[model samples]
Target: MRYTVVLSYAFTPAWLSLSRDERNAMEEQYIQPVFAKYADQVAARFFDAEAFHAQHTDFALLETEDLQAYYHLVEELRDTPLISRQYLTFTDIRIGVEGGYRTFEVLTRARE
Candidate 1:
């Protein structure tokens, strides 16, 4: 089985004040390794932008064979400073298996 995981980040007011290189460096150093550790069970890709634009943001797509591993990866990421301070969103998860249909479920919290 294979799954596609998309992780996106929207900057907060404080995050917006940082330089692009600063933010990129932080993500590269902190986040990339975490994703890389599970590279065998998962394959990951990243997207980054120079500034905050509705159409532009940082994101990652992970292809994984283990759903449990994927969930664990998400949990691990949630604690990272890069994610803790940013508005995070994940989507485009699809399961691929022969002779079966693909499905996924996501639970999102409503902002206060």
Candidate 2:
């Protein structure tokens, strides 16, 4: 089974204070390493939504087969400056399983 998680976050004033180069450097130094650690278990893609939305500035789409690894990935990120120093504030998280209904139906139904 595969799980998809959408994590929405907004940049705080602290983040805006940084130059573009600083932001990119921070992402590379802090964020990228966490993702790289879980590369085999989880896949992540980031999207910018500040232009389209009022609340969230960005959202990350993460697909994973291993929930434990995903959980660890988030834990590691939480310790980074992005979250610890209030550079980014997490607003919401939505998790779903791809084609999960079929899997549940098979597991819950009576067998002949």
Candidate 3:
């Protein structure tokens, strides 16, 4: 099975002021490790966030054999400063063939 994941970040107004490199550094330092930890179950094809917008969105395509393991990985990394809201969307291509994208939204608050 394989999964394509997209992550979006809903950023606060203050967050938008940061430079692209600043935002990228945050992910590279904090978020990337979380994903790398689960590299065996999920492989990231793309990881990027828009730094000039009030709402920053990070998108990624992941290939995974175990859905549960992927879910666990998402759950673990949902609250980091690099992201506000982590949305995991899964698409099942077949019983064994499943892939989806995830969107992580970086926001000011946890619920928003």
Candidate 4:
């Protein structure tokens, strides 16, 4: 079964105070590394909320074959400055509903 995790993150006061360069450095030094570590296990997509939504600053959608891999990735990310320095003020995780995308995948496989 495929698992999908959708995240809606709001910016914190700490993040708002940082300069552009500081944010870039944090992404390069901390955020990117966590994604790299889980690259083989999960595929991630990010959306800048302003373009499509008004409630959150950014959004992350993660897809993985193993649900545990997603949990591990989140755990590692929480340990980084991304979470520690309060870059995110609020977070909402939406667990996938198995019957939606999974149904399409299963039917496609059956056709083959």
Best by lDDT: 2
Rank by TM-score (best first):
2, 4, 1, 3
Clashing pairs in 2: none
Between prediction 1 and prediction 4, the one with superior TM-score is 4
lDDT of each: 0.66, 0.96, 0.59, 0.84
- Give model 2's clash tally: 0
**Which sections of candidate 3 miss by over 4 Å?**
6-13, 47-58, 84-112
lDDT tens digits, residue span 1-112, model 4: 6778888888777887999999899999998999998999999998888577667889898988887888898888889888887887546889785567778898999999
For each candidate, give its TM-score against the true structure: 0.63, 0.94, 0.55, 0.81
Clashes of each: 0, 0, 26, 0
| Tens-digit lDDT track of model 2 for 1-112 | 9999999999998999999999999999999999999999999999999999999999999999999999999999999989999999989999999999998888788562
Q: Write model 3 residue lDDT over 15-54, tens digit each, in one string.
A: 5677888878887877788888898888767655556433
lDDT of 1 by residue, 1-112 (tens): 4567665655566776888888788778877887877778877777775375474466677777788888888788878877676634443344444323422221222322
Per TM-score, the best of the predicted structures is 2
Question: What TM-score quantifies how close candidate 4 is to the native fold?
Answer: 0.81
Pitting candidate 2 against candidate 3, the one with the higher TM-score is 2
Worst 10 residues of 1 by lDDT: 103-112
Local distance difference test, candidate 4: 0.84
